[model samples]
Target: YRVGKAPVPPRTSVPFDPAIFDATSSTFYSALSNVDFRIGAGNAGAVAVRFRVAQHGYLRHVDFHIGSGLAGVYQAGNEFENLRFFGGRYGIMSEKTSPAWQFTLIDSEFQGQRNAAIREHEVDLTLVNVAIRDTPVGIEIDRGYSDSLWGKDVRFENVSRAGVIVSAENSVFTQIGFDNAVASNTPTFVRFRDSGKTVAGAGPRYRVSDFSYGLKLAGLGTIGDYATDIQMAPLARMPARRTPAIRAMPPVRDWANAHDLGVKGDDTTDDTAALQRAIDTHRVLYLPVGRYRVTDTIKLRPDSVLISLHPSLTHLYLPDETPAYMGVGGPKALLQSAKGGNAVVSGLGLWTGGVNPRATALLWKAGEASMVNDVKIQGGGGTLLTKGSPIGFGDPRARFDGQHPSIWVTDGGGGTFAAIWSPNTLASAGFHVSNTKTPGHVYELSAEHHYRAEIVLDNVENWEFLAPQTEQEVRDGVDAIST
Candidate 1:
């Protein structure tokens, strides 16, 4: 067994044997680099090639057969570079520890496998300049693991089903490219679990030529694309808007100074109930100068106005791990109006805890004649002043997860939205509008640098996009916008 970095001998034509190379007590190897264990085609699971990275083990420039032997690369906190994994049913499955095993791959390629290229379970995996092609599924991050998966410059070419299936949280994919392949399933390129909050960045030349859907989100977060060709149909517009009732409301109370209701605008305190109290009692709920923490979703009743008293003095924050909004009785959003109503939300900055991908700043389901004005849902980029102070100015932690959104409007319609700025969200469509009874006017809407397409409108009636700006050209599914 070699301890330190040494020039290892090449096993050019030696058939990989499991009994001799197994890292048991009798036959143990410390490290292996620049070794080639090439095996030809054989039956399924006919041979087994196994290697374990002990305390300080490293594997580099190792070659193996494609879809032949049961090759298990088990390691703990190890580095693998320049490794070529050829065809295999389960090409190089990781038998590492759950939630602790860490592996780094650099300049690696897994090609022509019948089954998955790389299957990992509860491992913190990082891939740099890695390519996986001509396989059924490219990479599968198994479930029941809550760790990180980071990849940079990864390419997937001519895969059958899914390119990548992520079941973990806090995953980041940068500059991923897909060429000349059909991801048959809708959202076939990348599919995430409900808890997966991923940040993906693709260059302008990147294209998913034939995929059912580019990204499918089950949780909250955002997807940002600098400029990529996601060739799919747009989302289908709803037939008609199910408009909600419009109600008149009285004036609101001063939330910060309302000590009796225990509405403290301190960043430390959970002000969800106090703010709800203000909403129920007054027609309008005004926010004062302070950082307010909201843990759960605050469902708005009919006929109310929630506005920031001073833009510089108010910061509404939704912390990490905030449950996503699924349905009527499902997860809650920061500010949601499930039942469409006549409400107004304006003049504030909504920030997230930079964790949960399912956290949405504002979800408005308002009826006709509603208005949302001068609101900024600040994520990774953009500067917001609260109470004469610049909050989250140049703060790198101000980013949003790919599944979270700045604003989502559904069901009801006929609302006017003006001056909404949502930027740098990881992978969400900045302003998503669906199924409105009547179309409304949107002015000065900026949804820039989102991972997915920006400003998605579905089944909207006579809705006008006035001075709407986005970072990339919006691409839709086949039946999305071709009316």
Candidate 2:
């Protein structure tokens, strides 16, 4: 008998029949054909496909099984091997598949395995634009004045700490004004350091417009540390113009013809009393360019006269033969008045032809209200002659016997003398004031002197010896003399 052929089984289960299944089901079968036959399509959807693997091991076939849905419906056998899978790995086939029975391996193990190897990827992107604004704050530029770009004016605040070096070639702060009515107690400008240190580099070159009053560097820091470094031209180029409220005082004439009395130019008559008479008239007494011999001490009373030396080339000589001819005695001569009086003596050269140790060129008695401006007291010959008595009219024994000074004020009260030039050796004190309740109120002494009484020297040049009394000495003297 011929070997009997086993009857051929049906192509596939009912759900997986190629003739009955649409292209979706056909494609799904084709994609899963490589799976083992032991895993049936009945449980295809029930099996789980893990994307993440455990440590030290690749995925094993045993961990994979048929999932539910269409994967579970079809059994895995020879009949299913010829089938195709598409769409979700093994569920359905897409209509887009070709007529050559082509199928998509989408959602399949091979497709996922191919894509899993890729890691780094690239993509394109874009960007956009944006902007911002700012406002200035208010700050004080000087005392009683503040600046704000938004509110008042543009001004830099305390720039000393900002480490900014500001330099203006020709630029300036124009129309900068301030109010003087602000209480004097309030600082006009704060000084970071000592006086004159803040603006030390340049002379007064900077000019402020609309601020007629002078601009003073109010601080004592290095010039570089100033908020601004200004190189100012002369005032003639750009005259300062300020509102009347803050305008500077008018210019004062050094000599006016309206209030002057003429005097002889020869060293013959004692013009001291005559000059004093003219001074008492509240007018200037003019000493023509000549020597006017002084005989007796001439005192200047309060509100009496302002003796003005003519600007012409003339000299008023204090003859060597005479004693102290002009003794400015009275409280007015010392520029001191219990009722607040003022006097000024200006533009005269007070010279003593004799170098008498006893002869003082100008004798200032106690309690005088006087100021000597632009006056020169020179020792003519350098011979120490004894003629005029010591300054204080008290006993001559009371005077210090050492080199008597060219200008001496004794039995003093508060007084002032300014703008005086004395180039002579003072045997005792160049300028002395003693024996008063409040003696030695002199300020701004400029001269070459051996000893200087209590005085504040401002802008003074070439002082050989300035023996200003110490604070303790001043206090002790005040106490001693007041008693």
Q: Let me know the TM-score candidate 1 reaches against the reference structure.
A: 0.42
Model 2, residue 178: distance off in Å is: 19
After TM-score superposition, the amount by which residue 236's alpha carbon in candidate 1 deviates from its true location, in angstroms, is 43
Q: Give the TM-score of candidate 2.
A: 0.35
For all predicted structures, in order, the TM-scores are 0.42, 0.35
Off by over 4 Å in 1: 1-260, 323-331, 384-401, 472-483
- Every candidate's lDDT: 0.55, 0.29
Q: What lDDT tens digits, residue by residue, belong to model 1 across residues 1-483?
A: 223332333343267433233232112123455567655566555433444442223456577664466543533334455678776676667655321334556567787877688776644565655777778777776675444455544666666666777563343322233323222222356655554533231321233443222233545776533332345333232122122211222334333233345777776777888878877776666776677777777777677777764333467776554454322342235777646667787666777555545666778787656777656675544334333123342455444334555687776755777656665354366787778766676644656656555677778777765335455424221222111
Most TM-score-accurate candidate: 1
